[model samples]
Target: MHKTLDKLYAGIGEAGTGRSGVGELCALAALSANLYTLVCVAPWLDEEYGSAGELRRRIRKVAAALVCRLERETDDLERVRGVNALFVLSNTAAEYEQKMLDLAEPVLGRYEAGRLTAEAALFEAEVCRMMCNCYCLVQDEALAADARTIISGWTAVSPSGTEGLPVGVALARCEAAAAYADYTGDERFRAVRSAGDYGTEEPETICRMLELHLRCGAVSDAEALCDRIEQDAATGTDRTSQVYRLAAKAACELLRIKDAGFSE
Candidate 1:
């Protein structure tokens, strides 16, 4: 469930709200989606708790507040504008079943959608910045590997099996792929394929590929791509270029680590 929450937050963070109204709407939708996630997840908690009904009541109170907030914020927008919002809601709800099974775990092992949704509004302008920092903090060796493995497994699963699963599985897969590529050297893990049925074209996909090249000691290729990406960035406001710049920085870090005689 925390994974779901994190992904939704990440999307809103990526949207960069202060830049445009569309971005703000995306944040609202991301938050609202987390609320909706709680709605579906709370019902199951009824069967799991000693005071199941009471716990559900509390959870619903929070969920209802979130839903009402979303409705108020997004009512003026058309269906197209609400697409990301809807995605957020469904993805959060999808994690409910699995979270129920983890009730006994320490640290609760769940992301609070309700709380995250609330925070999304309070920190709209800097959401993405904070998300990147927060993720960097929590993404240790074990957590990074787990996140990657789960995403790889999720993307590789049959569509038929994923039926009635969260609709945002693709987005989740993308998030996981990004982290996996950064923290681990496993290049087989890719995001969605291209339209040519060739290879992944997702913005983050470029980062993974760049990182993979660096990991394999393909410094020349990585350096060349970095140069090309810098040329693309010169025009300004290119998302792909921004991603490439980050990847290039990572590649440079890898080079330094190697120069320092870091070993496997």
Candidate 2:
């Protein structure tokens, strides 16, 4: 498997440069898809069927080579196309993806050049989906940092290309921001509020904003946001089950806290 990946990488490197033919693009795309398959699908087979131990090991090795290839390709794409590094991560396994993210977090700077789009907020949201769903055990510090970078890159427009994200990406960002604040004891609500790139102002996002305001003791502001949320809900725009339910409960708590003067 490692040898197969090596051949693919070599072919891509050779084909990626000084090439203007469909063959080059097709080869690179095949590598991307195959790499994604290995990263995303093989592990599931191993865990469920236990029929591919040796193949899984080779998959791990392929991941290492893929990381290296991503570095060079990201640089090349950054200078030329701005769309290569992420393809390596595009279809990777959730758990393996988490491990790769954890491994790559320290060296993320190396790939920053390749991730230059200003409308990558949705992409970051996808990252959060993987983190919350599969990499629940990952360290918050790394996740928070990645979120900060991705959010900062976003435009203040509605979130774009969010169809592929988890249903709760916005809410997770709120939790991430709050966690970042708690973890570093620093103010980081900016990332939470930077949901413009999501293309849609999800009910969950509004709820998160309200939650953040309430957490910061901004009673009037939170209440005002609640009014906005209610208006949206009444219009049949805001539709989320778990998040809306949770937000309603949180609102009640905030009301009680305000009445009791728990925070002034």
Candidate 3:
């Protein structure tokens, strides 16, 4: 048990260079998704299953097509906990960089140099935020320092950056950019608010801003921002408008999307 923890700790250093391709980043992203199950979901398993060995025995009674299972042998809580707690935190930054590079590589290799498309930058921002959450989960926050760097790469501007783009992609970029400034600390909010990259008044942007303000412990400001979104939402009566309203409502609760549960 001691040796296992020692190994996890020793491997905590940054792993790969930030040069992974899109396909490779995609693979790591998938790994992170599965690992998320163990970290976030496994712990919540109803110890109702009894001892770990009994838990394994009961799991074998299932007849569904589920792709995962708790370990079948050992019952050591420390070892079970250590694998999930440490694995992602140890390599989050490296995976973040690779995902960032995957977004940047195409722009660099093609007609543009160093410029990021709104869609690509948005995905990168998502990865950055995901890394921050994962690091925070394990109490290893040093890697979250990448938030500022990641946001800075969002050179794409709305209209210009989002020109001719699908409505879905544009909306997602708004959320991602808003979150980028969010995790960057409050000082960035004003800059991002006024930057008009994804457009400041967007409900998605406003909701994210509200959540950011809440995260910064400014509940009053978040409420004010939520009100502003509600007011601005009167500009349309289309389906998209309705979607924005729903997203705003959900985003108002200071919720963070988490892993899918593995336990019944």
lDDT of 2 by residue, 8-80 (tens): 3343333234222222332333334333343343344334223344434433443444444443553322212
Alpha-carbon local distance difference test for all models? 0.35, 0.41, 0.36
- The order of the candidates by lDDT, greatest first, is 2, 3, 1
Instruction: Show the colliding residue pairs in model 3.
Output: none
User: What is candidate 2's local distance difference test score?
Assistant: 0.41
CA error at residue 245 for candidate 3, angstroms: 1.3
What candidate 3 gets wrong by more than 4 Å, as runs, is 1-118, 139-142, 145-201, 218-221, 230-243, 247-264
Lowest lDDT sum, 10 consecutive residues, model 3, at 61-70
* Candidate with maximal lDDT: 2
Give lDDT for model 3: 0.36
Error of 3 at 112 (Å): 20
- Measure candidate 1: CA RMSD: 17.9
The model with the greater lDDT, 2 or 3, is 2
Q: Residues 30-96, candidate 3: write the lDDT tens digits.
A: 2222233333334443242133343232222210001011122122221222222222223333333
